[model samples]
Target: MKRIVIALALVLCAAQPTLADKVAAPIPIGIAVAQTSNVALFGQEQVNGAKLAEERLNAAGGVNGTKIALVFQDTAGDEAGAVNAFQNLLNRDKVVAIIGPTLSQQAFAANPIADRAKTPVVGPSNTAKGIPEIGEFVGRISAPMTQVAPNSLKQAMKIKPDLKRVAVLYAQNDAFSSSETTTFQDAIKELGLETVTVQKFQTTDTDFTTQVTAVLGANADLVVISGLAADSGNLVKQLRQLGYKGLIVGGNGLNSPNMFPVCGALCNDVLVAQAYSPGAVDKNPVNKDFAAAFEAAYKKGPAQFSAQAYAAVQVVVEALAKIEKETGKKIADFELADLRAALNKSLRTGTYLTPMGEISMAPSGEVQQKDFYVSKIVMNPDGKTGSFVLVSE
Candidate 1:
């Protein structure tokens, strides 16, 4: 009888799951961004940033020794694609939180789904106004256009105090560009500059001859462009080719090195408003480490998109760690729904040292970033390579 009882006890012990099994199971987080289409230029950088965060966090013991797994879903630069990606991450992948859907237009469509599903979302590049107001679960690391869009104009005024006429152009189809242009126009009016013309173009439009002719007709001394990489770069190139020699100020949308290839030699001297700069090595040690890792991986400096995406990942991980410490329970052991709810609450309560500098979230889910920058694109003589040389902060 004793031998039979011992044998049954041993079998029961073997049938139960072990702590090792629980530790081995990674906590899933979703990354939904455009990996295809014209927006890929920005999306690809975001992917690189998030991947680096995953590797670094896992190596350092993620979420109190519970590893994190980043499940990727390509948003493909459209509303429908973003919706599909969010649905898959929420329902199929069962992610705790999500980061992305690159454009504000896509975010408008996709963020609501996550909000309704009670999943937390961090916007890496969706800078349109009212992004955080999408829901209580939605927040962003990217600063609003109100903070970032006016810096370039201020910098331009410093360079040319006599500058008068300003022509504004933007991608009308893009929600970000549309919202950003409003801010730009307000700045122009405040500075008492004449509004020579306002031109609109679709994100898909390649032929900008009509827009270029209108800019020339007005003889605008300064041309401000608010559009994405491909279209904005092409517009800058066309403006230069058609013989407009005045200073060109680009919006936050053109704040990437990807603009170099699109406009070539003409990309030089375009002033861009920036939220992140890899050149700020002396200010923050975290930025120094991030920039080094990025350069090692890509053989080039990181852009704003990369830095913001990395910050988003860091926010999630740190919040989880906080939860684990407060509750004295591993995040992996918490019910998924409970853990996610805790994370949303924690994200709004802390200040983070990110590549963008020290930032904290307002109760409204807006990121209150301390630093903003304006830089001028300095192209090499080869016209194929360039860097954003910081001018003001």
Candidate 2:
């Protein structure tokens, strides 16, 4: 009877641990970027950066020695796609936090899902005006149009001090391009430059004959474009082919190297405002390490999209560590809901030295980044490749 009682006690003790004592091993973080569609150019870069961050962070003992798994769901460059991706990541994958949905329009549609669920989301490249205003649970690593867009215009004026009339063109269907054009227009007005013409096009449009004709008819000395890779790149190619000798200013959307092939040699001399630059390696140690790692992995310099995505992943991982430290509890042990809430609170409370430079999240979940750059594309003789030469910082 004594032996029987002892065996029964042992069996009872060995039973599955209670929910309070169970640990959530291998933390899951969702990456919901557009891995398909026309936006894949930017999305692919973001995925590269996020994956690099995951590998580096995990190797260094991720989140208090527990490994983190990145859950990927393609948002596919549309509002519906983003919403579906968000739903899957939140409900099925049960990720602690999410990073992405590439464009600002997607963010407007999808972010509310996470916000409503009280799950944290960090936008890698959603830079429209009202992204942060989405919800307390939402934030972005990318600088808004209000801050980053005007720099390119300012740089253009510096290059051509007597520049007078400006033509502005954008993708009417894109929330980002629309918001960015507003900034460009405002800056043009502030600089006392006349609005020669404003032309609109859809993201799916290939031929810009109508728009290019309007720009030339106006005889605008400068042309500013606010659109995505394919459309913007095509616009550049057409503008140059039809003979617009004046300077061209590309919005943040053109910051990717993927724009190279689209415009060929025509991409040269196009001015763009940057939030990240490989040249920053000389000044920032973090950027130096990131650049080295990036070059080794991809055999090319990292672009703004990659750098921003890496920073987003870094932000979430660091925030998780902060939560573990402050709460005196392992993130694995907290309920998923509790961990997410804690992470959102902790993520906003600190400054991070990212490749983009030292950045912090505001109480409202807006990222405060210190540095911005303006660069000009200097295409190689190959015409299919180019580098964004640092024009100013």
Candidate 3:
């Protein structure tokens, strides 16, 4: 009888749950972007923005007083890298949601992984067409190039009414640049500008002599170049150096402070289409507050990529709060699968006043943002510093 009692007590004690096991812990949010490699120019800014979001949220008591944690996985500027990063975040870190894979091409390859696993993903800068159509779990804060890309062309034509012979150039290897070029072409047609020459180049190529010579040969009055910051800035510098500049208009890719160092004084007089503008502080208190906070931390106005990444994290945090409110459970206490599903659904139901102005997630994982602006690049005499001066709505 003594042996039997001792054995029974041991079994019951072994089955009892411990305090550590029962108590929920801080929520985990995953950030997957290129923290290294060529894309890191943009990805580093994204990381900074996400960290700022974490700091501000935690300081203000982070989602009903429960702390939130960020898990970073560098995507390293390639498709395979993005896939590996997402896998680690989902499987190893057990993160509730993920916020990256920078380039649109990378998103096309890696977003499906998260969608299949039922994890929510918010793309900060994937602006190619059909990005939101990837799956129920994928969405982006970046507006499609179709919506905002044309405004700058129109503004350019307005600035130069004689800008009739238009030449369009884009990096063929990039999905976003390809899509953006198509939009630019369509807009050029709509605006009744004559298409003089359409040029193509690879993103990795540094020399634009052939393309620049072609544009000059065509005697184009206005030039449109669609490529990432490094390549696009080089294209602009080469175009200027080759004495082929009439009026240069850039795709969304050139709308970054990173382009300043790449193009130097040559980046001046370049018109860029923007999804978010610091001038928006008047109508958007969120933008105003974010700009102030970001300037305080980084000593400069936040770029669109950084602001969009900040908004992505903001969406996840706010959506998680909604899940907790409706389900009456702490974030860490919710089952991972159920939490992911619930957060995806909750994020689509509300409009978030983000740094990009009033924005919301569509049921199909598309972003709906209200305002867009066009700006001109104004570089200081130092040839290395600049700002985007707002020119049009």
Candidate 4:
């Protein structure tokens, strides 16, 4: 009879789910970004940054020995794709947080899903206006155009003190570019430069002869472009090829090394507003460590996209760690809803020393970054390699 009872108890224990079955060893965090499509140029860098962050954080003991596993979903550069990715992350993978959907346009489309689901999200590269205001659960590491764009214009004006007749160009379909052009236009007016012409293009555009012609016909002294790496770089190439050269100031969208492949030697001396510069690694311990680890892993210098992505992952992990300390329980043990709420609160309460410099979010979910810069692109003699050399103090 005792043997029978023991056998029955063993059977019951086996039938019930085990801890391993209920909770995965490495908790999953969703990384939704463009892995295919034209935006992949920037999205690929964001993927690299998130992967490096995952490995580094895990190596650092991983939120008190609870490892973080990243699950990537490609948004494919469209609003519908971004919405689908966010839905999968929220309903299927059940991630504690999400970091991605690369562009501000995607953020505008997909963030509401996460907001409705009460999931915490961090924008790695969405820099347009009203991003954070989507919801309390939404926050971003990218500073707004207001903080980063004006400095580039100021630097450009200093370079050509009498600069006038501005021709502004942007990717009309992109939320960030469309909004960024308005900021650029405002800055142009504020600086007392004439708005000679405003031209529009799409992110998918390759032939920019019409826009280039307009810029030249207007005889603008400074050309301000607010488009992504590919379109903006091509515009720069066509502008240089057609022989319009006073000063070219690219908005936040052009702050990528990927621009080199499109513009080549023409990338030289282009002024771009930057939120992160590789040289900044020298001043901050966190930046120094991230740069070393990122280079060791990728064999390349980390750009602003990568830096911001890394910072986003760090924000999530750090918040998870804080919850672990406050609750006296492993993060994996917390109820998913409770954890998400706690994370949203934790993300806004502290300052982080990131590769982008010291960053803290305002109550409204805006990132209050301490450093903003304007860098001039210096293309290699080979014409296919380049870097942003910081020019503004």
Candidate 5:
């Protein structure tokens, strides 16, 4: 009888759940970005940066002892694709938050879905004007067109104080390009410069002979380009081929190193305002470590999009950890309403040490930082491409 009772007690005790078994599953984060398309170069860099953040967060035991799993969905740089991607992430994957849609146009479409679903989204590089106006759910780390375009204009004026009669070329169909063009136009007017000619093209259009000819005929002293890498590169090449060799200023879209392959020798002497410079003399350990890791993984330096994506993920993860610490509940347990409120409050007050530099978010979801530099594309003696001489603002 005693043996029988002991055996029954042992079986009952074994059937009871252990503390480890009660632990929650890992949190799921959705990464909606343009993995393939004209923006793939920038998108790939953003993914690499986000992955680095994931690795670091996991290595540190993740947020509140729960691992974070990044689920990726390609937006394909289109509105329909972005809507579908966001739907899949929210309905099927059931992610806690989303982190992309690189282009501002895609964000304009996809972010509404997230807002309606009450899911938070942090943009890695959506710099179009009026992005945050989508809703309270959308936030971005990249500087707006209003900020970046003026910086480029200021750099152009510095290079040629007498710069006047500016020629502007942009993709009229692209939201980012349109927004940037407006800023460039306003900046030129503010600087007391004349707008000689304005040329427009669609992103799908390849040949820019007519626009280049118009710009050349306008006899402009400066040419400003507002388009993506692929379009911007072609425009630069065509502009140079047309023999208009005054000063060239590129908007944020032309800041990528990929422009080298697009414009080749034509890329030389083109000035771009940069948001991130790995070689910057700033004494931040986070920047140094991120730059090294990025170079090792990507075989090249990280761009502004990469830095912004990394920073966005870091901020989200930090907010999740803070919520868990305060409430003692997993991220999955928090209601979407409460979570969004907490996220906004936390992001505004929290300081993030990103690859770009330390960043703080304002109440309006605008990133606040004092770091913008100008870099010129110059070919090395070996014919390899690189940026030289960081100019202070």
Candidate 6:
């Protein structure tokens, strides 16, 4: 009888799930970004930023003792590619939540999948207006173009108050570019400035001579460019090479330091509206630490997208931690509905300290903070190009 009782006890012990086993199953977080195409330069930076966040979270023992495993999918910077990447992450990888689809166009195409799956998605860089209109599942850390565009306009006016004629150049194929162009046009109209010419180009276009000729022929006082970094940088270089010496204003697409390489000396005097700046003198602790750590890791300054991506991941990790504290259960077994509620509640009320200063989300998934700055590229006396001055509203 004693032997039989001991045998039954052993069987029961083997059937029980151990805490170590539970914690061993890491929670999968999806990273969907444009890793391959025209926007790859910016997307690569966003990927690095997300990876940095993942590394930090995992090193701190992860959320609720469960490790975080990042699964990356390349969207290739197109609508179809975004759909495929999102579906693969959702259906094949079974990620609890997805982090990006960097471009606003990709987000518009891919966010609906997460919505239908009831999986939460936080955009790292989708700044186009009406992103929140996608669904309740959609959220973004980046400020909308409605806010970013006016900063460039304000800076342009400061440089040339009598800038009446503005020429707009944009990539018609990109939703983000189109949306930004609309914002620029609207802001110019409000300022009583006439749009002398609106030129369109493809993302794949290598030469902008024809477009530059058209813009210059219009005799505009300012030229505003709305496109991805690669195309926008080339456009700026081509405009200068074509002898169009007017003031240049770049939209969110030209906010990266990589633009300097494309335009070289021509990048001087160009002004851009930025959502994040390591050079910003904000006294927030979060921004200070993030700026330091980012420079240490990447050996370069962080951009608005990088800062926002870091913040988005931070908020998600916080939500996971909160869920664990409340339920005392692993995040993997947590229901999507419960997780979504926790995330929404946490994101809305909680203050996040990112490299862009303090940011919070509203119930409608809109970012509560409207912090933006205008920075001009100046070639210092030493011949090094940098954002010399930042003008803030």
How does model 4 fare in lDDT? Answer: 0.88
After superposition, candidate 6 runs with Cα above 4 Å error? 1-26, 37-39, 59-67, 76-81, 91-94, 204-217, 238-245, 322-333, 380-389
- Root-mean-square deviation (CA) per prediction: 9.0, 8.5, 7.6, 8.0, 10.2, 9.2
Writing each residue's lDDT as its tens digit, candidate 6 over 1-393 gives 999999999888773422321112577778898899977877888888888888887888888677888889999978999999999987677776788998887888889988887678888888878787798878877888887788888888977787889999999997778888999999989988899999999978889998999998999889999987778878988998988888999887777676666666777878888888767855666777777888899898777767777777887877778777877766776654556556556656666766676677777778766477788887554443555357554
Q: What ranking of all candidate models by lDDT puts the best one first?
A: 2, 1, 4, 3, 5, 6
Off by over 4 Å in 2: 1-23, 204-210
Better of 2 and 4 by TM-score: 2
- When 2 and 6 are scored with TM-score, the better candidate is 2
lDDT of 4 by residue, 121-224 (tens): 89989887889999998999999897888899999889889887899999998778898899989888887879999999999999999999999999999999
By summed lDDT, the worst window of 10 consecutive residues in model 3 runs over: 15-24
Sequence-dependent TM-score of model 2: 0.87
Q: Which ten residues in a row have the lowest lDDT in candidate 4?
A: 15-24
Model 2: C-alpha RMSD to truth? 8.5
Return the TM-score for each candidate structure. 0.87, 0.87, 0.86, 0.86, 0.84, 0.81
Residue lDDT tens for model 3, 1-393: 999999999888773422222212578889999999988988988998999999988888887788889899999999999999999998778788899979988999999999988889989888888788999899888888998899899888789887789999999998788999999999999989889999999999899999999999999999999998889999999999999759999998788777899989999989998998987777788888888999999998898878988888888888888888888888777777778888889989888888888889888888888878889999999989988998876
Candidate that scores best on lDDT: 2
- The C-alpha stretches of model 3 lying farther than 4 A from their native spots are 1-24, 204-207, 241-245, 261-263, 327-333
For each of the candidates, give the backbone clash count: 0, 0, 0, 0, 0, 0
How high is the lDDT of residue 13 in model 1?
79
lDDT of 3: 0.88
Against the correct fold, how does model 3 do in TM-score? 0.86
Pairs that clash in candidate 1: none
Error of 2 at 51 (Å): 1.1
